[model samples]
Target: LHGKKINNHTANEAINHGFALVTEERRSTGIYAYLVIGFNSLISNIRNYKNKVGLLDNSRMKSDTQWVIDSMRVKTPGHRTQIGSLSGGNQQKVIIGRWLLTQPEILMPGSYTPLRA
Candidate 1:
């Protein structure tokens, strides 16, 4: 389904154990919110925050999220700009960065993989 669109999203599927699957399509959905929310999710899950942070800290989240986006070279007008505002390549980078923040030993196989095997 590369370069195509699906009317429905199945990203909510369940997985056994602690595993992460980043699909190309999932790469573009809610691209704007993905960075903001995904950043908070990843940080909260991996750090000592442990849900103790208050909701008002979302500004902090947005700021930090923007920093990650900029560091990853995800071109946009600014950090506050919505994901839908970015080009296809930039949006893809955002999703990639979200996954990379996990620091998993990734195995992206086949032709879609960025690096040749």
Candidate 2:
């Protein structure tokens, strides 16, 4: 952060420093790809894509994904399903789980209002 605005240019840095965002646009390309790939590969990519660091091995990846699924109560057949196929709430849960994996310092969720009964 350091007083700089969080835009595309600063987003990566913010993420590295544990900043995350969840927007109403949950069906974005990245989220869709993440759903297709499943959590293990997603965590692997998150670790290696930007910094070429391997934070979690296969065992750890599975463990972490399970944790997320359990915590979010995401009722699905493991992490193999296309997240897009899930209901919107489940999809949001997956996205939230993904951001939570980042261990962010600040989490900004946008335009998420619960339905009124």
Candidate 3:
């Protein structure tokens, strides 16, 4: 959390400092499969979408979600599509996109089988 110690803060609060993690058991922990891709894409950084009066900035959320879809090359019909409909790899892309949207200073992705790169 930059130079600040984050010992007492809640997990969500820690996100404000641009730190995120993608866990090992992605199927169990990473995604809300029944939810739309748009929802999943923005959930991590959802608080940032609020307006001064606390209304959601839907257009911005959509735009960012689209950015994630396009940039990550996540093969989905659209943002409204359910995440469960996608293959495991594409789902992982969406999960990664969610954290990338936060412009994270540090990202820790857990033990997924490493790809040949």
Candidate 4:
């Protein structure tokens, strides 16, 4: 990994080549729109489309999302429940699934420390 801070171009290149990172803040409440936005929307957000036709591949998106969910064991209401509503463990799983959707060759997850009651 590069020692210096990564710029947008480097970050984009890394993502395209299957590099992903998961922060310790697992809730990621704002990204709870996974159900409504759909997996394809999320994937396409990182892609640079040459034309409009390349952007509307709904079937592929559905399958991709399903695969990630299954692989990550992220249980949800399938487009109904907000991801933020899930428990901490489930939310972490969802985050992992989201990164897996990118098909990363390398994944960097931040250290996890449970809160002490």
Where does model 4 exceed 4 Å of error? 1-10, 28-30, 33-52, 113-117
CA-lDDT, candidates in order = 0.47, 0.65, 0.87, 0.58
Candidate 4, 7-116: lDDT as tens digits = 44786776865678777765453255445424422542345322376565556666666665667666677744666566666666656667766667678887654422
CA RMSD of all predictions:
9.1, 4.4, 2.1, 5.3
Ranking by TM-score: 3, 2, 4, 1
Which is better, 1 or 2, measured by lDDT? 2
Q: Which regions in candidate 3 have their CA more than 4 angstroms from the true location?
A: 1-9, 113-117
lDDT of 3 by residue, 1-117 (tens): 657776627777657766889877778999998999999999998989999999999999999999999998898999999999998888888998999999988889998654322
The pairs that clash in candidate 1 are 32-83
Query: What's model 1's lDDT at 47?
Result: 46
Backbone steric clashes in candidate 4, count = 1
**Which residue pairs of candidate 3 clash?**
none
- For model 1, residues 1-117, the per-residue Cα lDDT tens digits are 245443423422211122344555644442444444334234423342234653345555565566567666766666556566566556556555555555444323212335212
Q: Compared to the true structure, candidate 1 yields what TM-score?
A: 0.51
Of the pair 2 and 4, which is ahead by TM-score?
A: 2
